[model samples]
Target chain A: MEPNSLVKLNEARRERQAAILLSEIGKGRDRVIREGDTVAGPLGEAVAKAFRSGKSGMFELDGQEFFLNVQVPAPRIVVIGAVHISQALAPMAKIAGYDIEIIDPRTAFATPERFEGVALRADWPEEAMGDGYLDAYSALVAVTHDPKIDDYPLIQALKSNCFYVGALGSRKTHAKRVERLKEAGISDERIARISAPIGLDIGAASPQEIAVAVLADIIQAFRKRELSAAEQAKGAA
Target chain B: MSEQKLTEHLAGNGPAKDELQVAQDWMREGRNLAIATVVETWGSAPRPVGSHLVVDEEGNFEGSVSGGCVEGAVISEAAEVIESGEPRMLEFGVADETAWRVGLSCGGKIRVYVERLG
Candidate 1:
């Protein structure tokens, strides 16, 4: 069958599964598991085991079994500089499902008031971004062009498996910053991943516009879209 | 099981079969019903390709293909499908004037299959 037809068939099959699951409601003798129920203890263990194996299981309830599956999506966003762009980017990123956290040494800049709903860490970048702070899904942005702050975090961010890493600067500033990054031991290949002069070339101007560009770049990175030669060069080195 | 548990299970599982079973049951029970499914999408379509919506004889709808733009037309077509006993593939593109009237942000095109599930 054609791919579209196959998709339709698969969807039909899924619909059938939903219908079966719905029909199973109240048809079994056993009850749905509630929190802290001893009867569900074994079933819960089995569910956990199944989840570890990337699958789920069916539990027998009064001679009938019902399948149970659980999926947990990982979420984390770490902004290296508590700049105005970070201020704008944090909320929008949160809306996109990231658990936002801001790390900067400037206590005045990183505060609860500016990032009301976000987690704040007013520690030096090198000290704040500890082990396990950066993960595979973590999206990090270095907007504070201050080398004292941006360079250290860039190294740490490159070392970690962050899904998106973008830096904000003018082209000349980024070029100089790249030289500094090289001095600090980031290879030409590894440093290529940084989206310096970050964001789509939308001619964005103000801090808000810059934030928009940065977020768009991150979205593009997330989608793994075809990048421009400049973007590819920045991403590869 | 209590009605609460039943409703909870339905909400949690949210499987296509659950919706299909509901739709098929309604269809078998002599109710006119139209089922709309997203078959293809390009660009930044709001919903995924396999999203579904089922409408009853009276034009009541469950589920969504998008925010709203294409749904009105889709629901209308779905109702016709239920009445006519024929399946129709309705394609809406961002560039389509009617598409913007409904609210597609981008020019992503999507194909919706409307069939009388009965």
Candidate 2:
């Protein structure tokens, strides 16, 4: 390939990747990297695989080798409370490669010493989520157990296409919470998006175990979304 | 460079700033380049599936597929790939005695595909 053409391709690929990363839609786009002298392979299959898996790797088609580089935005976990569970969940999410932020209006709970190395926002949920920070690539967990602190953010998260929306409470508390949400004009479908009595039913009793369940549930939700997107892409193809 | 500097470079502010960005920058600067990617792995590979190693015509490389074990060989093959405009699939593992000589003593197998990147 000529140097000029190569440069143009590289520039275009970079631009596309930058745009996707900035958008944080959690959908990965694929770029086909073929042998310099070979014709490109079936792009639809490549794109579908890349988007579905969100993994970059090489594949072969008709004896021609192609590398499908899939670019996905970093996944984010936005915890809506700086409680004990948030302290456990934030670092655990970080370890799982999620960009983490703790949002709570209570200054005492959102202190740096308590949640070290994690981003903390002492603003209300509406203000914090106003700038499109919570998108499809984000997972929001409400662990404050205070309706005043968790309700607005839960509503906001339900409205957005965030991959996961979870809140801590018992079945009775969640039932009451649902009624409150219904009174506040939230649709049943939207209210249903929340994983109330949050986290997997691993018989978790302590804050740490609950955090584990929560992160596992969030991962399950994220993977399910990816699988569905991939299936959709495949069906479209 | 020191280990500290290497760590800092890899940990630069965010997720290892897409290695493709480095390849693109080098390509725009009129440098011939080849990209090596981990396509498949068996057992306990050091890096995950999509790890990259970008090699320039002059043998300099950024990123890694096997940390340091198989990069030297990949870089050497990448120089040939850049010249020939052909791709190559490289395999390394403890299963092969020859691979053991080449330093893939980690008891895992990795398959890397190298292609010239425009």
TM-score of each: 0.47, 0.72
Give per-residue CA lDDT, model 1, range A1-237, as digits (tens). Answer: 112322333353442211011012122212222111222355555544443332323446567444442222244667888889888888887777667788999999988888887888999987887765665446788877788888887887787656588888888999998898899888887788888788888988888888888787877665553223344344334
Runs with alpha carbons beyond 4 Å of true place in candidate 1: A1-72, A225-237, B1-118
After TM-score superposition, the amount by which residue A222's alpha carbon in candidate 1 deviates from its true location, in angstroms, is 1.4
The CAPRI quality class of candidate 2 comes to acceptable
All candidates' lDDT scores?
Answer: 0.63, 0.71
Clashing pairs in 2: none
DockQ scores for all the models shown?
0.03, 0.26
Can you write out model 2's per-residue Cα lDDT over B13-32, one digit (the tens) per residue?
A: 32354566787788768789
| Per-candidate iRMSD | 15.3, 9.2
- Name the candidate that leads on DockQ: 2
Native-referenced Cα lDDT, model 1: 0.63
